[model samples]
Target chain A: MPRSIPDQSKFAPGLTLQLDADQLHAFFPLLQKGVAVPATVGCTLKCLLCDQFSIPADYVTDRITTIFMDNRPVDDLEHTIIQDGSRVTLSAAMPGLVGATMRRGGFYAALRQGISHVSGGAAAADQHGTVRIKLFNLLLAELGPLVLARGLILEPAELADLLKSIPDRPLDSSPGTSRVLLTVRFNE
Target chain B: MDKIARIDMGAAGGPKVTVGDLGEYAGLGGRAMTSLVVAAEVHPLAHPLGAENKLVISPGMLSGTTGSMTGRLSVGCKSPLTGTIKESNAGGQAAQVLARLGYAAVILEGKPEGDDLYKIVINKDGIQVIVDNSLKLMDNYPLVAKLRQEYGDKAAYMSIGSAGERKLLAASIACTDPELRPTRHCGRGGVGAVMGAKRVKAIILDDAGMKMRPPKDPDAYRDANRKFVEGLRKHPVTGEGLPAYGTNVLTNVLNEAGGYPTNNFKSGQFADSAKLSGETQAALEISRGGSATHGCHRGCVIQCSGIYNDKDGNYVTKQPEYETVWSHGGHCGISNLDTVAKLDYIDDNIGVDTIEMGVTIGVAMDAGLAEFGDDAAAIRLMEEVAKGTPLGRVLGSGAAITGKVFGVERVPVVKDQALPAYDPRAIQGIGVTYATTTQGADHTAGYAIATNILKVGGDVDPLKTEGQIELSRNLQIATAAIDSTGMCLFIAFAIMDQPETFQALLDMLGSFHGITMTGDDVVALGKKVLSAERDFNARAGFTKHHDRLPRFFYNEPIAPHNQTFLMKDEELDEVFNW
Candidate 1:
């Protein structure tokens, strides 16, 4: 277990799940777009995160049992917000693997590019989602409908299923599409 | 009330009957008795808008008396939206005022004969059928203003708008809040249509001084109420989080948890979801010179509602909930907050259920009434409905009509009512509630909190349905019991965290009745309420099959996560095992 991950399963039994830092680092490359990566990073941007059935392997420690039965024990779950000016470093392998992977295509991919560029979360390594509501809502208002009109006939109920399969933002390939849905304004 | 008077309406031959022959204040409160009376009075298959469909208003046990947060009321009828028994509760001085005037329940039956409008006024002496020809109000905003002018400012008023007047299936009953603002509505289940059928534009209340406080061991009840409020104020969910963010806070959180439904439930997350979320809403309120937190009723400690204004500094409406945001924004692929805000604006003025309106509009877009994300076009379509155009007639009728007109196979609904914001494929427990609830796909019907953890129970992996049924059943029972007390639903958070406060409610009952009560009795009453509702739905031709998630939920997989609704039929049946 990594030093940072806390075991929270003491109260909830059968809640343990985990991802080694090495595996986490392997996953980090898939989130960054335009960064070329080794062929080992896979083709078509179809990593486990975007797959339908894969759940995050992080386990919640059973708080009740952990207190009584075992004590090599994962310490407290230390939650900290990632702030600017904090030093961030990636493993030596991330640079090459991320740089070589094939890029993701379509609207989401382009939107993520703008999001990363604006939030500047991309520079440090894994910038999943920056807190940018207005930017996101406006772009979605514009692009999402166009995508749907182009024939992604998705029903409302299907969203939760989609979310489970694809955990990260899609990479944008179309240069002028603006990629994000929220930026578009309603034409008066 | 010591007076215990009755309103005759002074005019004749309306559907008038009486109850409370069981003859005790302790027997049944507002929400419970209303459900039973509706079941007993209206034919199971009667059209919801017909004269035969009765509307009942009953006060909580403590409303007319001195008690903290006791200014609550219930509006009950066979819902035009759900096509079943529905009791939507609200907090206003109306119920307290009405109760003090001496009536346990007010049942408005049959239609009044006229194009001419009227109003019903209740006071310490009796009921008066008043001539409202002078008012002839069309809009709710101006109608409340006229009502305040006629009756004093302190009077509690219950009125409906054009949507209710037209008998729209999704119409809501508008009741005044503590601020004397007509913002806090019994905002679901077509209660307004029921009131409108009686030809009553508004019911003006003026009960001067007839207090019928529960004759509990006074010290004990007071002690219990204090503890209850204190517990509510201490919890972050009820105390701080809700008041600060309002219900819209869930926009970002639910999205992060993979529970927020987007683009007609196609994706769990909306990238720009944060923009329309509670954070942005709170920020907007600050910038626009509006209050971020506002009280719904008198003496409410957990003030989780807000009044949001527009850019022009005009009062737009309450910062509509996260459910409203998700329903209009992501469901139809329209993320423009301003456009979404327009829908909230129309819904409040129109006096209809926002959930029903959004889903219906989305369905209209699905059927080629408008292009997806053509928010302007969508607005035009709704305006057509508002103007009573032919297509507007169908859309205004509700989700079922829209689904029928469009031939859309992926209708996200249960029992004719559209499902609310939460994507059940991710939050399976809420899905069970949507499927089984008599109110038809409602989230509030079953919302029990987690036992110890700050995080709630039923946080099942979105993709798995393993524990959804069991979790939903337990929650429904808890919720029904709470609703019977006429207490605010937000109080559930405090009760979940503190056993003492929860117990004190039961203790208050014991104090009032002069008999010892147990936790088991509360459990029994909850079961009874559910059984009564089940009986109503069954009689109304609602087979167990109707209590189901839409078929597309299983066949299609949502993108991004790619999860399907995997709960089996037999597993869903287990929801009624309790």
Candidate 2:
């Protein structure tokens, strides 16, 4: 057996995976626009926020207006790190004063001078892990379908946990009742 | 062509009513009309709750027309809470009905000599002011319910509840929505207290046998309206996102941006945020046999409001907006959506500003009156307001007063009004707005959130101070003009992004009045409105210092990002210089 899906060894005391940025985005195109992909893509991982993905240069130059990692908006993309079980979001230019204030490396970053995220906590050197991504507004429509169809990887336990949160009555035959459709294609 | 109706409650031998020409106020409507009247007539230094402070209720310029999203009503008076000129607005049937009844503004002047509550009924015929002490101290829901029986379901109502009756600073005036439920409110700066001072229990607008106000050129008006609706329908924010999840959709987006203002502005993130998010709430609402999308008013195209039913499939309240969710949910460290919904119902029914009440409760929690994340304790505090207990009265005085009473120093307010959901430290452009808006700490006053978060019109770096002052100034001016038109402010999303849609608005105005109006004219109108309001606030003893965020916003750094309000006082002073 392929170490029983979740594979206890995969989450053992000392395991690290240098998650490739291209492989991450290729497997989950929804990550391009930004969506909280759950932590099913296993292994305790560490990667620089800028190195986690290879987006079009234009995305950095003009397309992406804001970037948020682990709920806090990333003001400095290069210095910021994406740790295990983190949520990374990407967005095009958003309107309003707050939108500008949250834009990465934008002119108004001084307004939120006290609250801009600092790169203090590094990713755990060796541990088991999971991460989530969430896309919003325009990005949702721009990149949602592919993620739903191809589906990002999730640890079996995390998948089961998410499933339990859904009300039991709607889990039967009609997938339409659920906002997110999860299909179990294979079992270890 | 609309007439002004003035009611003098202080008149000897009962109340006296007079109908007159608009005269100098002829061209103004909505916030423009109300702000002008209050600024020109009322003494700036007069006690806001005294007879000297006049209350002006007016419909926007396009209120009765067939234009979509153009039925906002402006309620203006010197605010007892902020001690500044205040023009609070809301959407309901009242504006449309009152406008069609041929009234430009209804001025409630003077104060009632005795303690008797009065009711004013308006229809196609005329206006009637009558004494009805029976309606005294009744909450908005039951009071409107009683009126529905007498006035029938078609009439719209504006009323106050125990909070207003008690003259609390946080009191809000409730306006009945399409379902005749008193859910929509003019909830800011204690305008309801001014109405209470007038001893007016409710204002019923029948408008039966009246027709919609016809435009000067019907064909042109129809064309402009069609284009306006088209722009609204195609915009992602207005059409799809708002309709699908309502304004609460910002819950997840703002949370993800790390500016959600959880636990009384201590941090920008909430651990249990997903529980109260728009996504979760919408799903739950649908599963519980309620709609995930609905409109508060008939002509609303955005449909950002909805009916939230409890698990048993009974209506609790209209879908709580994002601010209400953050205020009652994350601000107080409570994440139970059902609890937040119930709190919303209580706030609406008792006629209190939900934002003020939520922030006050958070301040109380900081004082150890109740533990953070304690839902039952929050409910008890709301019940206290409903019951008009001593503790409730202090709480109902709003967040600033609550902070004083409880000795909690970290109060988030500007000019005495509590800040809305967005933290100024996290979003600096809004910080500039909060510090400078004439109406105090109001989000909708400028709504830089459009550019900062939604990317509707354009993008601004939300975290930086660069371009923030200009952004706030331009938005404030545009917003003042929009408020005067009586159009829903949400239309800004489409109009700001699409120049043609903006032109369509000007065309609608031109077609309605049989005159051409340019972009300059719109800017001029906005400037005119702001000048009137600024003049009033100045006369009311508000100086440049009054236009600033709480000092704690500068000293205390919120967690996660650890930011403080960095906008200088001098930069904020420049917001209204134009």
Candidate 3:
């Protein structure tokens, strides 16, 4: 059954739904498709992943074996800075020669040197903005819940079909609200 | 595994079989055994489907032993598709069964008289060659089911479908998986045509009452095997990712990296790639009562193969691999997983190489025979091949021939063989391998994709020419060696990452063979295999000119990456330098 979570954060005009584990798990495909998350632009990937998303640093280092920022493989999380409207993809270690090539700081990094993320010096200054984040494979289970609970921004059209399937209306209709803030909590 | 069985189909009254010692071919197995035999015996200039060309089937060195992931069967011949020496391997019970039957290689030679089909059964009793014209034109799935009634499920059956019977250039020889399904195949280079030319429809290998090949140092072999399995199980790629999703797991990552060949290599990424991604495929499979993780062979620990079922929980085919998915799903502009699965089953049943058939269809689509993204047209085209219509004959000949017949300007082939899924323009390391490998544009010949895209061994920039030659060359050498040992190529990921895992592999080989196998010895074996293959190809009129990607790859810039194949011809020539 669908459960609703009380909104405690200052962020207003958002939808907060508490779903069972299975319901939340169904959203993995959406994660792979990518959802927008508000973040401080021009910060290191490590900062966005750990400090902003509140993902454990150890989990980011150990579990997420492949990271892609703007379609380029990210080898160094500490130096590669996030940009506004950038697309970030996270995945567990993949299979095949292609999978190994996408690993962070992997031995075969040179194979994808042309597509590897190159840091543009240091971030000039941090600014409030949003970046798209995508989770794939095992990472969907490991990091998906955390990101969902933290809330993500999505187009109203994108979630319309998904929300229609739910028993309860996830958010009250507000005119001119182009984006919806979706926070998913799992009811054990 | 000490004896070599030779079957001459043109024997005086009937086909005859003779067993002999390995002789000069001692200490060889898998691709090494097949390549060396083809190199030494077969006349290089002979027609691939003629009596002069031989079909050598050999198991890997460690096959039939209590080793993990050692069930690969290598079939080598002069490929009718490319007119080059070829060795294609598949994972199935055939390798383990055939090896346990006291044969290192089963050599089928000489063409039979007209209009007769034969079935050869080998077991502890002896080898029997019987006329079986009744089995003519039967596709693989039904043919195996029929054969099982007589031969029983205890044996492994290797057979070709209608495509092979017609001697189509894209034919493949099917090897039965552990479930007695002919899903695994040595699916390249027209090896099946060679078998069909010999008028042999099926080869039943029954190893009942046979014992495992004994290792010289059993205790050490066991210990090393334990460590090797541990390494594979501990590594995230082998243990978790592969077992969870199979090789189609590559679709999303490759698509995201902008190296995935879509719509006949015109684009690098497919918009509907998520629909065919491993994550989505696996979920759908489970929902339909199919398996997401399955082993093609008994000893496979990685289980990168799976079962695909229809919406109503009926079996369709084994999980379509990454290349199969891309070639049929994205390259042909069809994204539905069910369509891909249906096509995969049809390809397996018809006994054609999926890569070749799909690429041929793509080329045909480019010719205006069918519109892109037309799933019905794709199915109809494949059905035409099965029916052997006039157009089907042209399409079944593979991509290069289809391109020539239809006047499609941008055919993706090398040495007249269709390129696998990865677009060479985006992944340049694979481009070098495609242009230079003895097996035409085969990705597995030297999987630069591992390093270039997957980062399994070491990193090389996929989009640049730098380090690509060395990367391809090194991978080719290493792959040739591993293919000889009968281990699945997936082991390369774990071994390349963990030094102890590599040493464990060496130890397994050394202890089993009663010798000190080192890294240097492995390289030497690989070189020996490559040198023999290259020598055969050269004798068969293949020149450096034959070692090149289709001109379109150099001229056409694919999207997302906006890059063409960057390696110079001179740089490609350096791949075999070592």
Candidate 4:
């Protein structure tokens, strides 16, 4: 049986911020730089994105045109498994030769045959672990709000600059914590 | 689009202008018109800056029509930089304006005596040649501003800056965008030097009263155009990715793929690439009161261009492109967007090719003239080019000369022209293109193909890597065909993926020209253009041996991939076989 991801907020002391739509969009830099999210490792990329992250499979198929796992271009989402400490980057279809070359199962995939992701089989058992997720370009606008609402973990240093900009916002994280669980609520 | 204008700068008692019908070259446009004219008229062995060499300026076949994305203008000549037949095109109002002025092409021949500068003005009435000595040595920004005072905002302008006046080998000819800013450039092969050698500083085109070129079947043309636009809008790359962040969006993806050359091609990845990524650049532009989506011309729907502003919300320059960002940012080990934007402005102001200038600076850094990440030093070097200093002259001659003078062994160039941002070692496919393209190391040389029409990769085995040769050949041929249409190459992304889009393009062309155009016709046109270019190069003493990357690319391995260019010279020679 697969293990479920824990409710990080229940045990881990963190901060909850209420922001307007603009501030939520401004928070996308954290995603571009990268943020950590806990998930069940050893699952297929489709399961990891759809089952765990709650991103609809149709949206994943349609919107996510480019994907890179640990800097290797990912072609087959079903066979490529998610491992612990994997750094995943998602983007919409990019322009130019290199952009086309990086698309998921694109015709130009032969152009970048050296760095393509050859799937290693899924792990013997599923285990809870952390993976870094990065969103770029159009994906930032599409998936950013959902990922922020679900929650993410950020380094204290990474949040320093953003925290300074939004001083009046509420903070509940303990001082000197190494990492903070951040959840954003958009005011309707 | 019916007649050709010939101006002889060497004619006795000042310059002479003659208008003639396109007798031998009747139905050609864009690259086809330019390449065919240069191949037929100019002597291959003649000095690039001499009287026997001619510069042909032409608009693409669909340029002045109501067709979408047809604003490309081609300028061809014997290259002063590469010593090869060259055709460099750019997007601006020049093509549409020139086409509406009823000129298929403008041929500039013979070199002027003495150092007198001249400007050519054309409107609905006629063409005029006036000696404009005051315009000498002015940069593109101020030169366009000054010209706008008299010509007003209703005309499209083409001019050269100090770099061209000095005949620097990396000089480019600037074309005015819709905003009348001289930001779009026909950059590469030192076409501006050929213009400067003719002593023509600028050309002004006014189509104030001229009507758009009429199509043979207006209803069919309009229907095809609507479907073509829908295809472009529906595609993810053309609709979302490009318009959102522009071409700089490629920086992150290329870096992730370990193909973004850094520190003079020593490595494939840069540590600070995130700082210069398109996401950050677009957000910064928005935060600073500038736009992240803009067009270079009136009919450009892709809107891959943008405006760059300083931290204080003041206009700095147009958004630096992916090549500009890579060449100046990671290639030289500098990672700041502001610095890259500043270098872009200076390069445009001096009317030099950004790819050539940035690569030259990187080679200079490798030669120990300055530290790799020294942003201030890079700006100073560009300023030197503007001032025409001795060191600047050497640098302005391009990477090949810069490497020779500095004794650097690993200069990244082919056929005496600097390579663009993509490192061929990591991406072996582009390496084949860089090695075999007639235009010398240009990335766009094999781009904009309708792959469905060409049936690319169908015959070649997917397991064998030699499929790249077939892919490159078909792309280059189809690219030549598309370049003749004056269509923006971005449309290729939509057309390559959607068959309906490709059919729509054919329908648009067929209806406009009153012919039943097909895929075979496109392929034939592309082959004709490339054959003329190759024939001219062969006559100029180039052999199959010239179709190769620099020796260092094959000898030295780059990091991340730890791969060298694996394609053999024999395999590269197969690219032009078709």
* Best by the DockQ measure: 4
- Per-residue lDDT tens digits of candidate 3, residues B438-526? 99989898742222322323445544455667677877877888889899998877887777888898999999999999787887788
TM-score of chain B of each: 0.91, 0.97, 0.97, 0.99
Candidate that would win on TM-score: 4
Error of 4 at B62 (Å): 0.5
RMSD of each: 13.7, 6.8, 3.6, 1.9
Best by lDDT: 4
Candidate 1 regions off by >4 Å? A1-188, B1-26, B131-137, B212-214, B449-466, B512-517
| Consecutive 10-residue window with the lowest summed lDDT within model 4 chain B | B455-464
Question: i-RMS values of the candidates, in order?
Answer: 18.1, 5.3, 3.2, 1.7
**Decoy 3 TM-score against native:** 0.95
**Candidate 4: which stretches are off by over 4 Å?**
A1-3, A6-12, A165-167, A171-175, B456-463
Off by over 4 Å in 3: A1-12, A164-177, B448-465
> Candidate 4 — which pairs collide?
none
For candidate 4, the per-residue lDDT at B107 reads 93
Q: Determine the TM-score of chain B of model 1.
A: 0.91
Every candidate's lDDT: 0.59, 0.77, 0.86, 0.88
